[model samples]
Target chain A: MSELVKVVVDAMGGDYAPQEPVKAAVEAVTERKDIQVILTGPEDEVHAQLAKYPDYPKDRIQVVPATEVIQTAEPPVMAIQKKKDSSLVVGLKMVKRQEADAFVSCGSTGAILVGGQVLVGRLKGVERPPLAPLIPTEKGVSLLIDCGATVDARSSHLVQFAKMGSIYMENVVGIKNPKVAIVNIGAEEEKGNALVKETFPLLKACPGINFIGSIEARDIPSGYADVVVCEAFVGNVILKLYEGLAGTLMKKIKGGLMSSFRSKLGALLIKPALKKTLKSFDVTEHGGAPLLGLKGLVVKCHGSARSIEIKNGIFQCVQFKQQRINEKIGEHILEMADTSKE
Target chain B: MSELVKVVVDAMGGDYAPQEPVKAAVEAVTERKDIQVILTGPEDEVHAQLAKYPDYPKDRIQVVPATEVIQTAEPPVMAIQKKKDSSLVVGLKMVKRQEADAFVSCGSTGAILVGGQVLVGRLKGVERPPLAPLIPTEKGVSLLIDCGATVDARSSHLVQFAKMGSIYMENVVGIKNPKVAIVNIGAEEEKGNALVKETFPLLKACPGINFIGSIEARDIPSGYADVVVCEAFVGNVILKLYEGLAGTLMKKIKGGLMSSFRSKLGALLIKPALKKTLKSFDVTEHGGAPLLGLKGLVVKCHGSARSIEIKNGIFQCVQFKQQRINEKIGEHILEMADTSKE
Candidate 1:
């Protein structure tokens, strides 16, 4: 018989707080009987929210009281160091102490990033643990690695990012032998800045994953590559820009539809279809980005995440553990490093 | 009497080549008699394209014979050096020799960037010439500086980029005291990597423009700043991503609208309003990006530029000339530098 996968969720982390996280926890446990959840927050608040979900099995979910809360604006390192009893830190501690199989939070990105490393720690030989998100594209979605997880990265670090990204796409995403590409200004190898210039050749030579040549920012949405590797700075810019543009475009489209009566009628008729199409592009439909290379899984949902996203993030951990992604990643990277040395 | 602004159009550059450039030249001359265009390309081809436009004033529009074409793939420095008679080089040389006030091209961006600095020369105390493009935003448009022309930039170079961006926005775009922000992962000054961290305080204390704190990429489309400054690599990623996302989103919207009969009907009804709204986000409606800090203006239109875009780029030169933008930029940056040193 298989053991239950214990998932630790930060109930006080996101904008919606205990309501959404507690609801998502109930939804998760109800959906999968094999899953057990430990909700960390103010015990009374969590219990009250959980009581709202009457159908959730009473014994399957438990609450771990965390007395403190970290504001998203607070400095990350200081918060992580100071707030030991906060939901974010306590959840991460569950992963660190092996009380839970995985940890999920919608807290401050900086706090999650810092706590993931300081608490969950890194796998042996892992240089950096990148936050890799599955970004929707024309051909479906691609993995964007190192999105502000590690900045001012060297060529070797980027090569590792490509490998870890490839592992996530291949094993977890179920994309067989994902094609990896380094982001650059132009497709030509000589077109990038210092970091990309130095990393291009090394990526081209890195075996195991199918390493495509350079990918321009223009090519990213075309689904030109399954795994797009970049330094945290570049990746962060791309991610933020992607979110910003999608939102503005959506808002404009709605405004356009409301400009006239005829268009308003049309908008009503097509609302469902348009909503569905736009939903495909929404990153929230997918789970939070996992801070890969950590000893135990540390997933960060969006700060504004609600129940659906929290639920998805929880399920993502189940899949990660089921596939034994960390073991595969550790092995794949170590083998690549050895071959490169040889 | 004000002298006419002579713009040397690379008649042989771009996908449509002499057809678009020549048509644009005729349109420019007809629209404003004070504008003159010198078309540089093969003598016969330029004349043949010009012949199609019989209404173009012979005095306002003239053809300068050039024998060669620099393929987009040709090495930039080598092409600018060896292909002296090529349309791009010949046109740049015309600017260098003061035969034209500006050079407009839809040719290889690399060649134009290289030739502009080498031939047109930099204004005194300009550390690096950045290609600044006015990108459409929610409020209006924001200037994105250092879009891949100069990379591996230092904090000093980024400060210069911010100053030049501010000058262009104020003197050319007609924004008074443009709000300038350095693009970073998060809004905090301490959030960015090495370059941004170093540049943040310097820009804050640098007097001239209205210096806002760091702007995340998500806030860019919301028109958070008039001038967005970054190192060339980060700036290039933001610019390219902006273009790519807009294109991809537009395509997806069209596809979604055509997915069903209801959506198709709605699309037909909303076509006019939607078209008008989307047109505002189109970068081509705005003029080409000027390689700022050069003696003579060099504007690079999109490589796939059509007649309308080519025409707008040609007229953009007239405003730059009338406003004496380069002098304003030189004075603004030099003044800021002096204050910072003190």
Candidate 2:
């Protein structure tokens, strides 16, 4: 491994693309001495964006040239297969070759998920790789595993997700034996469908994690669980609903606040406090979803990621590396197997 | 068939039973001339509660004796089977025997769902009876079908839910050719789990209903579709999240508003207009969930339902009767079969 932690970023990927990624890389490298960033994109555009930041430290960030770009609308697996010279492909190749400690992208989720599994590969003993994202809750942010990957997922995959997610939360995120709960329609153990019902008992029996009983989707936003578990379909629904409903309610609240003259004045006064409180409930600023149970670290940020989110995504790789999260996860999986044998 | 649209209510059910349901019965009789209520519970207890309302039209609200009560913790199917004289069972029997046009309960959802199907029975050719609830949306209240009834549901069942929900929305909720959408993780036709993938084409070809394609959970609060279709698991998660997150946000906003004196003054000015807007998003104040596709209507209100929700639930049955909703639904199902055959 390199002395300085190296993170490969898809500079041509998000909606803001080269500009945001370029700015984030400069900020990340400038802010930390033990980290380096490799920007993968067309040489000219990436260099032009980097040149705009004249005062930024130039030595810590590198630019790698790629010939093609993956458009958002293109088929994900096909795009990854066809555009081997694209920024996403080049970045993944860097991680696979161990030239980069981790890869960060604000590209197509489908492409990232497909390429991560096909190229970087899964960890030994892992049946499937899960995409785990951190969601802002009332207490703090909670990690939701299998949010988009592994649709029609079986109970065994859910068991692995719990173990991998628990490891990440404990070692990297630094939560102490994080409280894990399976998402069910009701809190009762017997209340879920076939998948949840079968997984509930296995999760309870999981070793080395704080396993709480089943939790309903309603209780999620209240910070009731440190790690919320579900298959891809249920997890995706919860994630999207959390985003959509929170957004609509915030808009409605703002509109309500602006309806009258007195309310507008009040809105002005409470603006700072409201922003602070809401920031605690907004997790997108924290970082991106990590494709866990993989051989190497891979983080997928939102397609619309800006500088803060992109920078945060790059920074999380330092923790993953310094904490040796992947090695610990491999050890945990073996430990779980040994425990099950007993 | 009766001169008035008669609804039997379980007076001993709910968290505030014998009080809220009793008061709601009185209110319903006073509000509408074409409706009557039958209170089924312990004769003396129900009568003493009704005596508190001295000026109520006593003749329009009748009392029927029931000796037992089904607690929320009892096994639903077994409770409906064993509790022959319990308020829930007796109330359902009244509808089964054609003495009442419908039955309303604020009791255990399992018991209500069990008794609604086992006792009141399904309309001819109805495969599954679904619990459909009106959720407050930005545009208006939208009906979410099978919100908790049919867990582990099949694709064919989803197709039927779409048809049934569309009919109810058109006739009862007064939406014309209501747009039906199956709940999905993504809007793309090919993107979803096994159930939605199978149900999409079936709903698209369904007769006598307007079928839109897939809808993401995030788009739900915007009222993108009049009838949101899903099995109980997805629907329940959506409903509970909608309630829990919305409640949490409102509390957080109120806390923010009350943080300072200036905001407090602003709160007073925006109170009425805010109240009006928020009320449009509060579906509980409107009514309860209806166990549709039953021979006779059976509505399950919230356990904490008070006078207003109970009164509205009783009132909604009048429209179910006058519009001949069940008959219309039966016709629609037959038409779908004929279309499939062709």
Candidate 3:
């Protein structure tokens, strides 16, 4: 077997907390011999959940007790500063100390982002670390870079996001020469606000990426580009709106299907195929948002993530480590710097 | 009947052009007695379309000759400057000349916005003219302000949008003291970028409006707010993405329903109920986006609008005139200016 990729899992984070994390850790270890999980939380709480999975690999799973829990509503900076013994902080610290190859958490996005930047630190030559997530599209999936982290970003930061996003999609997602597109109000070159206008040419002129021109928000769901780039505020709105609209539409669709006896019967006939189609679009089927450009890998899952999502997040980290994404990013940034210098 | 609300129709605008616009003009006159429409395009072309509805109310509709047309892809500033005899320009000039009460078009959004500002002009003390569209939601419709007109908006501009949105919703849409919310990444006050952060406190402090705190983009489709305010870029993305996603999902659903024989049969049985339910969520059912704060009303129909939507757009203009929306806006801005001075 290959060398193990040790991933630290935050057991005290997310809506389901220790139970889902513990279950996912067990699932991860059982599915692969080349991966190990370090579970961090209150010892007894984690142990009680772990007890239910008696057949889990003993050597591959270990517990790291941390008594404190960081609440999602607490200010991220303050929580990271005050709660050093919290599961989130401990997991991040483990990555910083080189005790783990990656850290996975379904914690407060703010806390994880702050800890990822302040503790694990950014890779050399990175302007700002971005939270990039794989969003399902009609064709397959596209990586939306800078969804939340680095909200007030400049054009230079956006160009870097495009480059890094292309790298992640091409290597991690296995798409060759992945197309990178900047999210804009119009497909026209002269349209958009100051930030997008400034970033457009920079991205167009950037080297070593398939930089497709501006993409309207309407084309995003059709999967027109492999990598979608934008500053964090616009990206965050797009991500949340996408999720929100999908949920609303699903509810409305269900309500429509149940309105009459004949329709309900029709719903029953279409349920299996429709369910499968909807499940494919479910974001949790994909993994967590990775804080790209960090020296060590850190992944932030949804706060409401269940065991399946948690397990997928763990597997995502394994892939990241296996592909040496951070090292590749480091080398790419250096090449960019050298080109700029010359 | 009440005083006639004279609306100029851009016969050379939109995907369907004279056919849809002329049909809508004839339909509007037949549907109501208190409205008149002036069709502006190549005189012969407008007359040719009008000939089909010869039995219709000839007295309520008139033809205004214009020899030019503005393409959607043309630059807004240059188009407005150069296309002097264009249908859009001729229509706007009528409003500016007080020969028309309102201008309705399924034309270039950029050109209409620019023309509305440069021709019909802004009401005194009005900071910016917002393009407020009534988007269908679970409960009813909510006005999404500044979807395209002003992209890089200041806090003051946002506050103005909020106030104008409230006035229009209450007076035009018949919602009493409509709940207003600013779109943000998080529900927390301090969670946004510089513009939203500055606008939050100002919105909170503003009197005579129902000011709700921050609303995440996820909560928007659930009908949580009657008036949703954002700068243009974010709002445009939200609007387009909503439309695009709905279309994509509908296509996917139709595909799913036809994937199997059982599903195909079910689709036939449920087709009527499903169509009715889905039609309620159709945005074009609501009407065109109104260029609020313009001295004379300017309604922008979707570029792909059919006769029904254009007819709805004409009716929307009638309602605005009946409600005296522009007058109310003028008084509200005066009150705001007085309060700020105090």
Interface RMSD of 1: 1.0
Clashing pairs in 2: none
Model 1 lDDT per residue over B139-227, tens place: 89999998878888988888888888888888788999899999999988788998889999989878776998999999999899999
Of the true interface contacts, each candidate retains a share of 0.78, 0.63, 0.65
Q: What digit string (tens of lDDT, one per residue) describes model 2 on residues B1-342?
A: 446999999999899999999999999999888899999999999999998989977789999999999998888998988889999999999999999999999999999999998998988778898999999777777899989998989988888899899889999999998999999987788888998899899888777779889889889888899999998998998998888887777677677778778667766766775676676677687799999999899999998899899999998899999999999888877777676678
Between 2 and 3, whose TM-score is larger? Answer: 3
Regions of candidate 1 where Cα sits further than 4 Å from its true position: none
Task: Give all TM-scores, in the order shown.
Answer: 0.98, 0.96, 0.99
**DockQ computed for model 1 against the true two-chain complex using alpha carbons:** 0.80
The model with the greatest DockQ is: 1
- What does candidate 1's lDDT look like per residue over A242-339, in tens digits? 99989988887788789899889888988977888899899888989999998899999998898999999999998898889989888987787688
Rank by TM-score, descending? 3, 1, 2
Q: Where's the lowest-lDDT run of ten residues in candidate 2 chain B?
A: B265-274
- CAPRI tier of model 2: medium
User: Which lDDT tens digits does candidate 2 get at residues A1-342?
Assistant: 447999999999889998999989999998988889999999999999998988877888999999898887788889999999999999999999998989999988888999999999988878889999999876667899989998999988999888888888887788997989998987778788999989998887776778998888889888888889899998998988888887777777778777778667766766766776676666578799999878889999988889899999988889998889899888888877777788
Give me the candidate number with maximum lDDT. 3
I-RMSD for candidate 3: 1.1
Q: What share of the true interface contacts does candidate 2 keep?
A: 0.63
